[model samples]
Target chain A: MGDYALEVTNLTKKFSDFTLDDISFKLPKGYIMGFVGRNGAGKTTTINLITSLYHKDAGEVRIDGNRAEDDKVLYKESIGYIGDESYFHEAFKIKDIVSIQKDFYPTFREAQYMQYIEQWELPTDKKIGEFSKGMKVKLMFAGVLARDTRILLLDEATSGLDPITRDEVLVMLQKYIEDGERSVLFSTHILEDLEKIADYVFFIEKGGEVFCDYKDQIMEAYRMVKGGTDELTSELEKEIIGLQKSSVGFQGIVSREVGDTIGDKFLVEQPAINDIIVAFQKNMGGNHTWVQ
Target chain B: MKIVISNHSELPIYAQVKEQIKEQIMTGVILEGTKLPSIRQLAKDLKISVITITRAYSELESEGYIATMQGKGSVVLGRDNDLLREQYLRRIEEALETAIETARFLKLSNEELIDMLGNLIDDE
Candidate 1:
């Protein structure tokens, strides 16, 4: 009913040790949003809540502007989930998965399913257990795409994949949203994948939202600052995030606006996604009030 | 049309796409009525997000360099006189940025650089 294909507002889930606190983000139709954080950063917890696998303590999730509570069938029809683990039985053959899919999804297209199977070179005779990690990922994608689901939720789907397999997965994600009718929420700790294809990034830290913005804006928002250790005075240290000291110099992530105002007093360079994430972890104690 | 993207560049990926396409269109390297690669096709080829190409194409459409017909892909527009002038001016700005960078590296004062430019032109 809205432009967004997926919307989660104030989504919270609690467990004994951890609470996924106030996780909120929207994936607009026709785009991919990388749901990123380190391991134990609640990335999977948030995905579970989004898929309604876990009961939420608060907030709601809407798929295509319809809540699961409001329209269960429609919500279910709209999503395809690809977890890091194989959903099928280890003994199940490709045809077994296909038959199961046909029973579950009314929109399943057998021809499309077979086409992807052949295209990805997935063997029909082999059991799921015989498949390599890349082959398993392809098989999962083969199932998900055949259902013609409009939104895809991939949780750590690329972690164990080799580089070539990851590239294949990235291409699949790009292809999925080509029509501008679909969206994807890909949760992974792998920043390399996110950097290549994420339209928006929702970075979670310690069960809380750290920052969410367009991928371009995220890259442009901060700078890596470097200077001699003395230049990193106590007063100056307050301005930087995750400040690090060596015998020769110190380097840290600094707010770009602040970096600019400080002029050339420090060497400011562009930061990679890894730099930003690491800096966040290092400076967690120092208050990231500056990170938007 | 050919596009080369450099990760080291400060220009965002989308902006790089837009500028390159704009340059090609203005210079007639990409001709009028040329069908630009569909957004998805470009993204796959460039190994970038579809959003980046979408942003680039939309910006191109808004700037009147190209037109997107529903269901069909974008196609370049006929040249405009004012737009052509603006494009040429952009080339000069880019050239000057390089010149300025070199001058600064050499520690040439702004005035000295301007005087050098004047002397070179007068000698020509």
Candidate 2:
């Protein structure tokens, strides 16, 4: 009914130390939004809240126009979630797990499941614990792909995978959303993969949202400015968002507008998503120091 | 046409796609009336999002490099010499702008910079 496959409005959760402060964004149907953040940046917490594994302290999460909290079964059925760790019992075989999943999800297609298993070359009789980490991840993907799910919430699903396997998975994700009725929220620190496949980006830092925008817009809006230390005027310093200083020069991020005002005094380069995130983290007074 | 995207490059993925396709079209690598892959097919092949491919294709269509038909996929349009010349000139101007800036920063004389350019051209 709604254009957005997944929507979160002012979602918040508090812990003893960190708080996910008013996280909000929407994943439009048929697009992938890369969810990026540093370690312990509440990415998992937000994913947990969306899956209804953790009750939200405030706000709402809507999956395909259904309230995630009110319609738990429908919400859960709509989303195919894959986390960093596998939750299957160690003694369970792949076939056993598939049968169990079919019972829980009415839309699960056994033929599709078998097709994926054959395509992925996963062993049906192999014990879950006997599979390698990569094999386990593939198994998880195979299960999710066989279900008629509308939304996929992947939390660092590809980190354990090799480069070749990761590329395959990325291709699989692209194919999954080809129908124009599905959406994905993929959370990972691998900005390169995001650069390849993500239409939009949602960046978080220390449990707070930094920004959310179309990937191309972000690339055009922010620039990496580098210049001699002597050229760094107080006015220019004031314009930068994430300023890193060294004896030779100062490098920082500034909007294209501010970059225009500085003119040729500094060398301006396009900022990657990784660059933007690192700059923001440094600006937040995180432990990372600018290397150069 | 084959397009390779570099994630580490300064240009955005869509920009890269647009530029590469334009290059192929200008060089006649992609002939007129050639049927380019559909957005979904290209996205799947490149391991990129459909929206990104759509953006690139839309830009190409707007620039007259490609045309989209009703049910059929996009087809490469006949080359426009003026447009191709303009594209080449813009690239040369960008390169010269950076070259001039660096030369000025190094306090190189106009004659010296010209001589250097001449030598490089001769060598090439």
Best by TM-score: 1
Give the worst 10-residue stretch by lDDT in candidate 1 chain A: A283-292
Question: Candidate 1: where is the Cα deviation over 4 Å?
Answer: A261-265, A290-292, B58-64, B67-73, B87-124
Give lDDT tens digits, candidate 2, residues A1-292. Answer: 7999998999999999999999999988989999998899999999999999998899999988889657778888898999887778889998798779879999888898888888888888789899888888888988898888889999999998899898888888888888778999999988889877888888888898877888767777788899999888998887776788899998988888877766677788888768877777767764332221
Instruction: List the candidate 2 regions with Cα displacement exceeding 4 Å.
Output: A228-231, A246-249, A260-263, A285-292, B6-10, B69-71, B78-124
lDDT of 2 at B51: 77
Model 2, position A291, has a per-residue lDDT of 26
Q: Give the per-residue lDDT of model 1 (tens digit) for A149-237.
A: 87999999998898888888898888888888889999987888888888888888899988888887778788888899887778778
Q: Which one is best on DockQ? A: 1
TM-score of chain B of 1: 0.67
| lDDT score, candidate 1, position A259 | 73
Task: Compute the DockQ of candidate 2.
Answer: 0.49
lDDT of all predictions, in order shown? 0.86, 0.86
- For residues B16-119, write the lDDT of model 2, one tens digit per residue: 99999988998889998899998888988887767788999999887778889876999988766455456668878999999999999999999999999999
